[model samples]
Target: MEVVVGVDLGGTKISAALVDESGNIVADVRCHTQVEKGREFVIEQLTKTVGELFERAEGLGKRVLAIGIGSPGIIDPDSGVVVKAAVNLPQWEGISLKRIFEERFNVVAFADNDVNVMALGESLFGVAKGLKNVIFIAIGTGIGGGIVVDGKLYHGSTFTAGEIGHMTILPEGPKCACGNYGCLEALASGPSIARRAKEYIAKGVATSLSELVDDEITCEHVAKAASKGDALCRRLLEEAGRYIGVAVASLMNVLNPDCVVIGGGVAQAGEILLTPIRHEVALRAISPAPVLQSLLRENAGEIGAAALAFSKLAEKD
Candidate 1:
């Protein structure tokens, strides 16, 4: 059997897996991304992990055909270089990931933004399968999106085309990590949701969330509280959903994809989060054209990354 290796480089961990053409995992491995140790260490970790995965695939009688990597930050897919990354990993900027990996592994290697890889994965195997045009939006510690057009992942000129997170919904609202004000991520991401909830609690809003967790209140906590009828938490989710809806609405007006898949940590909020998003999309989005809708939530990143590798292997044929 032929297999391809997929690596997902995140702020905290590096997960590499050998995936078959059918989107099945033949082998998998993981390692911590010690950010404080700097870029060399992270790259070394990725190298070693990929090598090990290759060996494991060999042991399983699967020939490694290619490799694909999904990483955070702005990537130039044509050049296989990372332009900028905010995950605080050392020396990640301007790294030629594809060249280095291909030379080291003696196989073709492709790299792109993690979210794009996820979207590709979904298009091939998951919820977005059979859809030619789709969007994959992940709401996590940060927000990111991927665009697939005509069955191909669309990496706009700079490979930064699908940065939906940076879309300014409120021009003068809260400060975002990109040094912008009122970007979608600042108002609707996991951290944003948690911060909003905490702000409400600080201002003496009565919420069961206050007593749920002692210290670091998270969006997960808020979702749980809302599930149990905590009015404040529900309201907070609704507010976040509204902001996200506005962003999605804008995307609908622009891309008009067949499906929008929502994933990542915060998506665990499930229907409580999606219901408001759908309602708000209907209300605020440009009318006449139906707004896009989410297909699947959760595991999108992993599955998408794996699918990307599998696709790369298939391309060789």
Candidate 2:
């Protein structure tokens, strides 16, 4: 069996999987990313994960082909370098992820922004399949996006075109981690949702969510509470969905994409979130398209990474 390695590298964790040509996972491994320990430690963790995958491949009579990495931040997709990123990964500036991995593993490698590859995954195997124009939104701890136009990923002039989270929806709302006030991220992301719940609790509002997670309340807790009919959590999620809808509506009006996809941890809240997002998009959009959830979900990152490698390689051929 021949397989490509796909890595989903994030702030909190790293997941690597060996995938065959048909998108089947031959083997996989994951580990917590102690990013605070410095770049070298992070590299060590990646090496261990990949090395384990290679070992498993050998044991399973598989021939490893190449590597694909989906990492957070502005990656030079053509060159496979991490140009810049947020504080999540510390001093991760100007690192050539492709060069480093190819040198270490002695194989071809490609790297890209996490959400970009995820969008690619959707285009290839998920909701946006066969669409010429598409938009993908990730609503996790933070928010991010990817855009495809004319069946090609749009990198924009600066390669940062899809930072949808920074779009200003609330002109005077809460400050985001990016130091921008009223960013969609600060208003609609998972952390933002949890923050809203926390704010209500601070105001002495009565909600069972407080009893669920105490001061350590998270977005998952809010979603869980909402599922159980907790009115406060439902209200918070609906508000976040509306905020997301505003942004999505804005994008749809400008891009006129055939499809838009919502993925990431918060998206798992399902219809509670999607319903309001749909309502807002329908209300505000000039030419509306259906908003749908990701079919791949957690697997999108790794699968998309593999798909990224395959696509780039095919282009080379």
Candidate 3:
């Protein structure tokens, strides 16, 4: 059974796993990103984590074939470099990630935007399996998307093709971190939902959410409140759903993918979120197409990174 190392690099932690061809995780390890220590420290930590995982798998009699890393930023797939990222780690810009891993492990190393890896995983072994031309959108603290065309991930000319979060939804709405106005992320992301709820609470609205937590409310709290029939929280989620639906409708008009799979933390809202999104999609979708729910949800990132490693190993054959 051939195995590969799959690494998911997030703002908070780095998760590495040995994955088999069947998408089974044989062993896994994790460590803090330690972003405050600078780029060199982060790289050293990643290298150590990969090395440890490789050694562990080898000790278990597993032959490691390749390594795949999913990073949160603009990644140049062909060059195996991270162009830019602003979330957790600093100074990751222009880092030759692939070369570092390949030189150290003496094996092929594949790296891509975190979301793209997630999409690849879904296409290969999860919900989008056996399907061509699919869209994977993850709505978490922020929003990100990946496009897979004809069973292959599409990296547009700069290898920054799928930036669904930056899509302008409201021409004159809130300002976004990317210096854009009214982006889908600005309106419907997890932070956006929490912000809206906070505003209502500040305005003296009587909501059950107020009694749940004292300071710094979160999307999870809002979802729980809404589930208990909190009108304000429910409204906030509906509003977010509507915004997400509008964005999906526009994307459908442009790409018309076979399916739009949504994942991430906020997706846990489940029917409360999906119902409104579906309603809006039906109302505004240009082609009146069907919207499919995500199969892998929160696990897409990890599994997708693993799939990418498997893909790289297969390519070498």
Candidate 4:
């Protein structure tokens, strides 16, 4: 059996998996990113994890072909270099991930933004399977997205095509981390949801959400509270959903994709969040596509990275 290694490197953790060509996860391993330990340290962890997957694949009589990485920030796919990353990655500027991994493992390597990889996974094997056009949105600490068109992942000329979160939504809305105002991320991301809750609590509005967490509240707390019918939390999440819906509707009109897939931790809010988004899209889009949750969930990135490796390997044939 032929297999490839896919590594999903995030701000907090690193997950590596051995995946077959058909998208089955043969074996997997994970470890802390320990970002404070610095870039080389994180690279070591990634290498060690891939080594473990390699051993496991060999034990199972699978031949390893290549390696692929799904990581944060803008990646130059041709160079396998991370041109820039968020603050969470801490000094991850201009790191040549592809060359390092290729030299370390003595195999061909491929890399792209993490969310783009997730879209690739979903398009090829998950909810968007057999579809030629798809959009994937990951709502977490921040919102990131990926676009797949004509059955292939679309990387714009600058390789920044899928930055759905940064789209200016309100024009005069809240300041975003990217120095933009009224970005979809600034209004609807996980941290944005928490911030909305905090703003409401500071206004002395009565709510059960404040009693749930001692420190700065999280989106999860708000989601749970909304699930229990906390009016304030419910309203906040619904408002966020509306903002997300507006953005998605714009995407639908522009791209006309087969579907939109929502994923990431914050998406766990499920129907409480999706219902409002659907309503807003219905109101806004000319002809809205179906908005679906990611079927692969957390494994999408790793699986997509493996798919990338497999695709590259096939090109050589």
**Candidate whose TM-score is highest:** 4
lDDT of 1 by residue, 1-317 (tens): 88788888888888888877766777788878888888888888889999999889878888887888888888887678999875655478888889889989999888888999888887887767778787888888899999988887898876788898999999999999989999999999988888988888889989887775545898888888889999998998889888888888778778877777777778778788888778877776664233333343434545567676666555567
Name the runs in model 1 displaced over 4 angstroms.
212-215, 285-299, 312-317
What overall lDDT goes with each candidate model?
0.80, 0.90, 0.84, 0.89
lDDT of 4 by residue, 1-317 (tens): 99999999999899889998889899999998999988888888888899998889889999889998999999988898888876789678888889989899898999999999899888887888888799999999999999998877789998999999999999999999999899999999999999989988989899997776646699999999999999999999899989999999999999999999999888889988899889988998888999998888889889989877876676679
| Shift of residue 66 alpha carbon in model 1, Å | 0.6
How well does candidate 4 match the true structure in TM-score terms? 0.96
Looking at candidate 2, what is the lDDT of residue 261? 96
TM-score of 3: 0.94
Candidate 2 residue lDDT tens string, 1-317: 78989999989999999988877788899999998899999999998899899899999999888999999989998888888875788578889889888999998999999999888888877887878788999999899999988766789877898999999998899999999899999999988899899889989898997776556899999999899999999999999999999999999999999989999999999999999999999999999998989988989999889978877777789
TM values, all candidates:
0.92, 0.94, 0.94, 0.96
Ranking of all predicted structures according to lDDT, beginning with the best and ending with the worst? 2, 4, 3, 1
Report the alpha-carbon TM-score of model 1 versus the true structure.
Answer: 0.92
lDDT at position 292, candidate 2: 88
Error of 4 at 70 (Å): 0.4
lDDT of 3 at 228: 90
Q: Give per-candidate clash totals.
A: 0, 0, 0, 0
Worst 10 residues of 3 by lDDT: 289-298
Give the poorly placed runs of model 2, Cα more than 4 Å off.
Answer: 212-214
